[model samples]
Target: MCGIAVIISGVRINLSSLLPDFLSPCPELQQVDYFSIDELKAALRRRGPDSFGTKKLILHSENEGRVLLSRFHHDEVDTSAQSSSSLTPDYETSLSNQVNRFGVPNSIGELLFFGATLQLRGLNPISQPLVDSFGNLLVFNGEIFGGIHVDCDSNDTEVLMGSLEKCCSCTSLEACHCGGEGNMSVPELLSAIKGPWAVIYWQNNSRTLWFGRDAFGRRSLLVHWPNAFDSRFLLSSVAPTSLMDKNSDLDIRDGMNNLNFWEELSCGIYSITMNAPKADGYLAGEVKRLDWANSTLKELVKWERTLIVPKPEMQVFKEYSLHSNGMLPELGPQQFSASMPAQMVLSALRESMKRRTIVSKRCQQPVPVAVLFSGGLDSMILAALLNESLYPSYEIDLINVSFDNQFAPDRISAKAGVKELSRIAPLRRWNLVEIDASLSELTSEIKRVTSLINPAETYMDLNIGMALWLAAAGDGWLCRECNNDDDDCERIKFKSAARILLVGSGADEQCAGYGRHRTKYREGSWLKLNEEMKLDMHRIWKRNLGRDDRCISDNGKEARFPFLDEDVIRTLLGFPLWEIAELNQPSGTGDKKILREVARLLGLYEAAVQPKRAIQFGSRIARESNRKNFGSNRAANQASAGSVVIHKPST
Candidate 1:
């Protein structure tokens, strides 16, 4: 929710001279006129306007002093609730009080207490405390979800102090805060948590730093360690592209200095360091090292194998209800009903639209948001919802990017459908941009960008290219049609514009739109499929869509999936899969049957009646742009390697 930056040096250095320059573009910096430690502490506040906090450490040196600054934002809380008086508390009883109040889990008490910090915005702990029997300091980012607990007895700050005390007792005197116990180690703690996280801990007495991230790699953390100049280390959510000194070209023998590190795309929890090169400069020495002293592949695999089982059936849907602790309500069985699948589809679609439009009311002007429209069911449905909702008042725009590939199936008809929908929603403005980029041209680009090792890589490159095109055309939020039942591999690579990208992800799964659902129902295994299959399906859907969030967010854009809404999900849960399938089946030459029925009821039958074409197929994004482009039937294409065979145009 907030930006964080840190600089740690081996030798004492004055950070004040550079503080002003760094703080200029960063609005979070407070006033720090004096060299006093207290002034530095006062100046280092959290960046998020909605919440703020500061922590400072002064390291004594032979000359000047080295300083550390930490800041955080409490994004989940309301601005009005963040009062300084609420944070200031008596130190003695704070830890116990916070533990009781927050219901910190017993197993995670030591770790949570060390990094615990009060979130001013939400009046909750922004970071968990890292505590031991003695004292330790912990700093963590990302959520733990259903993992360990720390005593929330006091405010966040106090709990951290308490945890630090406990950890300091067990480890070596210098790094005692890391603790001597097995469960308290970084690897052990990571194994116990179920969600993404990046954590750093320091033992005040031991003078050591420990860093770790979640196994799934959902969050990004970067580090820079220069051996030649000061042996300083820096870590942040942003990448390390700009960490090196512009003027210095000195080389270090260890290969650890003046280097930037990032993990591979698929590796989990891979930690590498930037180090110095060997004296020979022949690339013989260790340039970087993985921090595996506390990690073991065997243990990680074992822990990962125990995946969480999903819930059974669609839970009843709750409306506008918050959890007892004020957290967002988790989707459960009680939130859905057992109804006809077609009705469920309609209900889920409406709910998804509602959630996607929920935005903070702080903007002076209506925010500009865009949806990537094609003449397809998903995109059309999303557009229809936006046309009626508060989204239109926010100056919502629709951009449909397509290519004029002759080989593509039903291209003309699809374009006609989009035109028809545009007329139906005449009050809204629509931009239909068409391109004729050749397959040969795209293939070269895909090879350049993806380094194409797999079919999945090729598809990802195409999506990225499409996103870049949309980004170039406008600055508003851009969304594409993404359904939960779609391939996971595809979801992992989907990206688009907008601070929040909206996708109709969960609708298909909840409403039984996938071909697999039809096969299962026809096979007469309804009882087995009905038990908790919906819950299991949702879990997979969330995980896949989550990858979309990570990939897009890596570029500073947030993704919002309206179909993931609890209301929509609950409605879909009540229906039978067969009924939903029938509604979606094309009626004669008409589009998705069930969606059209519901859209008609909502007075959007014209917009909804368009045929349901998958974006890749509809837009010809997946096919080559040449006459030689052939369908998946490779055997039939043996005699026509270079000749294109276009699909017959639909009526």
Candidate 2:
């Protein structure tokens, strides 16, 4: 929902040198130039455009150390709202009050803290770079679902910070014990909540910085520590453009060569002490040094599990799932029951859809959210659920996008499904906006899509980007028929009508929808099938999800995956291999068996029987993009951009 950037150092820095034009090429933003931090804020304004704020905090240190925080909002309701007051108070203004409590002298060199928050939720935006009563500061990106213990009225970030403060306070106490452990580590805090998030939290008392992403890195965060030998670091939600200047071709090449300077921070928690030797330390007869302690940077946790196969008790197979991230609690043995699986899965789907829809407090209006519908089993089921549950109060728009090919399988299937859906659950408005893209327009559009997903240079990645970008480019159904008559009559566009996108992204991975899963089962049975499924589940962060976030969020819409819901995933994982896939049946009859049953439960008989298809192949995007240069190898196209190492969460 927002982009965040940070700079931490042991010495004074020229802010201009730290920030360069590292953004992916965006045609709309090319005319705008940015040089300073303010300009960088302007460059990322589209991510959150409603309001803006910035804060600067000086750290208690011997040298000139600093932190900066800034943000913008995307709320269409009140773009004019701007106030001089920062969400995080200027540390300089609050230093005097803090000096008395800590008994630290003014002569100590100050460390600076800076942060930014982008507001996307209209009407009531969550204030960011929030400072707690204990002086700890937090700047967070992403939402915490309402299932958590926080008040529905308060901002999730505010509630998160409150929970953290309580945990930290309890840990610092001599007589207190939380979680049955003497002192709670930072990773342990994660076990309390579930949702997509990337956070930067600074502990004022300990002068330690704790930062990380969700179990699945749904939001992107890249870190630049120019030299491992130096004590300066920079972090941002978006990748910086390779070029400093647009006109200089040589500078562009140099920028590409220097791509090794920044790296995407791995998903999971990490802790580092921000304390550096100050003039006071030297005055106290301590030697000042440039090198930081090796212990300063430590990997506190990784988003993965260590499974322990236990001795069989009675006739059941028992396993203990242990998490490296202390935040997740220990899992008990998996229990199998004949009748519970269906009901459990259905309950999770219903709740996940609810949390992802109008039931969420995040929705400020009754206006309908859009779906990236392909009319396949995954999307059709989602549409049916939304139509039957929340249609009258909220208009439903099934936006189906395709390349210029009328005979494509996806196009035919989508038309059939839409017509059927219209007959089944007629709403106040069943808007279906279908788009057809031409080969002439494909080149420019591909460039734009690639620009949005920088470092995702691959044959498969390009296919995904092109498909999602085109789908998200549409306006609403109202302008579908009127575009030809009026050149000036603008389409409503995806960003304007829907702030949230309900996508059936994780269903394929969770339910064995791929051909590879079927192949694994045919050759090696359930053992191989389970192994392959687990790997896919783990690698989801590296594959489509990360690139999908960049492409989809670029349009100011957040994509929520109901299949990836915590409870839904757990239920699926607990199922026996037979429930997931009927290995003995012919291939077509077996794949995604559990999902088909769920669809049948919902009375979506047609959807329950639909066959599996990849979005790129189903949409004919890959075919269209490669039409002109037939039989061309994708490996050659890999050179379109340099490769970025995808970090896998390890136990």
Give all candidates' CA lDDT scores.
0.37, 0.55
How do the predictions measure up, each by TM-score? Answer: 0.44, 0.72
Q: Which stretches of candidate 2 lie over 4 Å from their true place?
A: 11-43, 63-123, 169-185, 228-232, 242-262, 278-340, 359-366, 388-391, 442-445, 476-496, 583-588, 628-651
On TM-score, the candidate that comes out on top is: 2
Writing each residue's lDDT as its tens digit, candidate 2 over 135-164 gives 677777777874346444456677677767
Q: Candidate 2 versus the native: TM-score? A: 0.72
Tens-digit lDDT string for candidate 1 (1-651): 322334342221112332333211111112221122222112222111233333333332111112222222121122322244343321111111112122321101011111222232123434333334333445555443324453222232333334334432223223435443532533344444543455555554444445555443444444443223233344443332222222133233244332223222222232221111122111011112123233343343222211112223332123212211222235465643333334556665665565445443333334334455554566566766766655444554444444444334434543554556556676554433333344555533433222111111224333434433432233322222432122331322222223434444544554444545545555645543343345445343223333343333333333345554434444443333333345224431222345555665555555455554544455555444323334453632454432222222123
Residue 544 Cα positional deviation in candidate 1, in Å, after optimal superposition:
4.8
